[model samples]
Target: MMFGSRGKARFLAAVEGLESAVRDRDAKRCTRGLREIHRAYGKAGDQEIAEGGARLAALLPELPDGPRGGLAVFVGACVERGADARRCAPAVLAGLAQALEAAEEFCERWAASGGGDFPEPDDGDPGPGVVERGGHCAAFGWWTLPQWEMAAAAMLSHVEVRKELDSIVRARLLRDLRTVTEASGHDFKCLEQVLLVLDDEPLVALDRSSGAGYALRMTGLGDTFQLHTLLADVLIGGGHLPGQAPSAREAAVCRDAPGQVPTTGSFNLVAPDGSLLWNEGTPADIPVVDGVRLLVLDPPPYRRGWPAGRFFPNMPGDLVLERVLGAEETAQWFTQVAPAKG
Candidate 1:
């Protein structure tokens, strides 16, 4: 949509206000300025948003580490508030690259200082953790990590950001992410998400019925046993499948049995036309949909001695499985299909 003269005026004013707010380090003013930009972009198209993001990216390096992170998050929030992530990805990735570089420098400096607090930069504004007690005075401290994390999470969650990365940058980012994840005790969600993107993993759909299921990013799975374990975990965790407490022998029996074994019954991975795709095999052996395997776990037989009740609650009695492919497609599926049913 073409911006009218008034809308153009509003957008430019909002951008000017945001620049002023960032320069002054005024958090409230920054937020208000962003909200104004958001309002100005109410009917803007992707091109307009992308242009706005480019304008915002120009101001990123002027801010401190904390507010740099905040601005990155605000961009993500704008995406969530109906700004297109793909359109905003260039700016987001640019900011992420900067944050990662800063974090790397901080890590090197901290290590060089023998794990003690390092001298703050001469920017007058105290860096990260410079006050409050308990070893909180450093050039970069605990305060910076969460900000970096939030920024990373916001950028890495969208697939388009990965497309914006060149090979060298992607490798550097993966390395830096590993460093940060290690420092943060290996519990980083952004790291996990990025790995999925890097490995070109598919989105796994737990198909319940026609037009209903839960979709999760596919993680590494070695074999059918691991796949079965994952399915059981997800199903039992979500209260869709009953928790099983089979006897030692029974447990062994189930475990020892070949692919896709239920606690007391049987299941199959079947195609939409009822042909068996995988009655027994590893995930790698499953059929591919758009370059990634899509497995639809057929509902377990409902029989006596087996766990009773609807295998997939709220699903139609006649189950018809469907599959979606790619990060973008699966994400779209989640937003459009799964939210209402799931």
Candidate 2:
């Protein structure tokens, strides 16, 4: 809930240290991370209010063998201060559990590939695991929008700050982030990468057990907020996320672009009765209509940004929704995801 130049630096530096510590299997570095994080809170104010700092210290030791769980837990705890904990706690706990499970899955995959035991990085130079240009950490960092939102939510959970969760605040935050990153003189791309690693994109779930089911694409800050809202609805409100929740234009694009894209941009989106559902830069997954591949792109060859161009050139409409939702649910879902240019 507190913000300043120095405090922000301490927070981020501590996060970087914690990430490195987890990767290197170093308990001492973990302790150092806690100290730094605590100092960050202190610099913001005293971590005395809500006993947040102490709670965080206690929770840090319970972090899994990976950085993801601890980072998420820390953000959740920090954000929960003075919040309606009874309302948000369940979702926070469930989200943390999901993060831990995801990290465990990644570790298992790494181990299965005959990857040997983990070892510490070199004394002076952290290995590719640390944020480096064109490194594994860089790639993971790039798409971590989900994690950033978790942190942002925590920062904004307080009553006064929560009021600023709109476009203006987003623009300010993005600008401030850019300024801070520039001041730090780190690689902007790498920083961007690190900030976005917490996302759960291309996947939607009714509950934790659904195991990455369904497809959802989130493009910007508004979508990120929408995602948090949807998750809160599911986890806290006991509601269900619809199987297909595309924008209105997106639905039309889906209907029009089945199996082929006649034009490059929005010029070709025409519905069955000659309604134009034209929109640009809307994204969708591979469209499977009636058990047939309706839209497909030639899977691009492996190279830098290989899959970026592999999307079928057109946006499909509500066929996926028709397959997945009842008429009532479909109507409700459309109302919920009504197209907005945020």
How high is each candidate's TM-score? 0.45, 0.24
Tell me the tens digit of each residue's lDDT in model 2 across 151-236: 43454323233333344534444454454334333333422322232211232221212211223333221112222323323322
Worst 10 residues of 2 by lDDT: 303-312
lDDT of 2 at 281: 19
RMSD of 2: 18.9
Once fitted onto the true fold, the runs of candidate 2 whose alpha carbons sit more than 4 angstroms away are 1-49, 54-73, 81-145, 157-159, 164-169, 172-342
Q: Write the per-residue lDDT of candidate 1 for residues 103-132, one digit (tens) a residue.
A: 555555556546554443342334434432
Judge candidate 1 against the unseen true structure and give its global Cα lDDT, from 0 to 1.
0.49
Q: State the C-alpha lDDT per candidate.
A: 0.49, 0.35
